[model samples]
Target: MSTRWYPIYQRGGPQLRVFLPNFWLKLVRPTHEQPPNVVQFACSMEMTKYDIQNYLEKIYNIKVIDVRTRIALGETRRVPVKGYIVKDDDTKYAYVTLPRDEKFVFPNLFPENKEAKKDEEATLEQAKQSLSDFMDKNKERPNMPGWFSI
Candidate 1:
């Protein structure tokens, strides 16, 4: 019962090849607090709880104790100008539980750099000062275009 198409097998022909399932799983930050052993993932809508469990266990080599799945209804909104309604695609989420002793922590992907922040602030101030100077120079000609100045 596979939908994937492959070349027909024949004697002495190339060995039949196996391909991975066309399932996608995205690791997303949990909107609400969860236990350390529970990890959240947004997966393809067609994926079943067993599929998720097997995917993690066989592909990622993670031992799964339990798997819970839920579907989040997508938001619906009206187009501001056309008066038409639009709906977003629904998302399926999987909550995987590992062994009691295992813990999963989301890593910090973006770390703030104080030095870079200070440099950005300094550049903003300089731009502000130059704009103020330009305004002061054009105080006498309110209607003059900024590009007219040197």
Candidate 2:
């Protein structure tokens, strides 16, 4: 018998459950120059080198030749008003090395559009010129509101 508080366990019941690891990895842009085959990643502090390698191999399907981890100490600061010390959470960085021939390039998340910029500048210039012309035409009626013009 099954109740709201408890349920009866059966031998052949659905006992299968999906397994998920409590690990997270985020690709980070390298601050300094690094080898082309080396990729930087920010990951959970609890994850080890082996875990990182296995995660990339099994989950991401990326071949990892080696993984090196380092823990960066969080910044400590004192609140100006309360005068209490605060510290940020520590971050774990993983350096994963790929095959000798593999190269990892950091993607440009924000690309500049020269054409769009030129168009925006042209629109702004037109608006400014129209405003100047309107001001010149209304020089005789300086006290009139801008919206009251025909």
Name the candidate that leads on lDDT: 1
Backbone collision tally, model 2: 0
Reference-based lDDT, each prediction: 0.92, 0.89
Error of 2 at 131 (Å): 5.5
Q: 43-77, model 1: which lDDT tens digit per residue?
A: 99888899899899888999999999999999999
Candidate 1, residue 102: Cα displacement in angstroms equals 1.9
For candidate 1, give the lDDT. Answer: 0.92
Model 2 misplaced regions, further than 4 Å:
1-18, 127-150
- Candidate 1: where are CA atoms >4 Å away? 8-18
Candidate 2 local Cα displacement, residue 45, angstroms = 0.7
**Looking at candidate 2, what is the lDDT of residue 63?**
97
lDDT of 2 by residue, 12-123 (tens): 8766544567788999999999999999999998898998998999988999999999999999999999999999999999999999999999999889999999999999
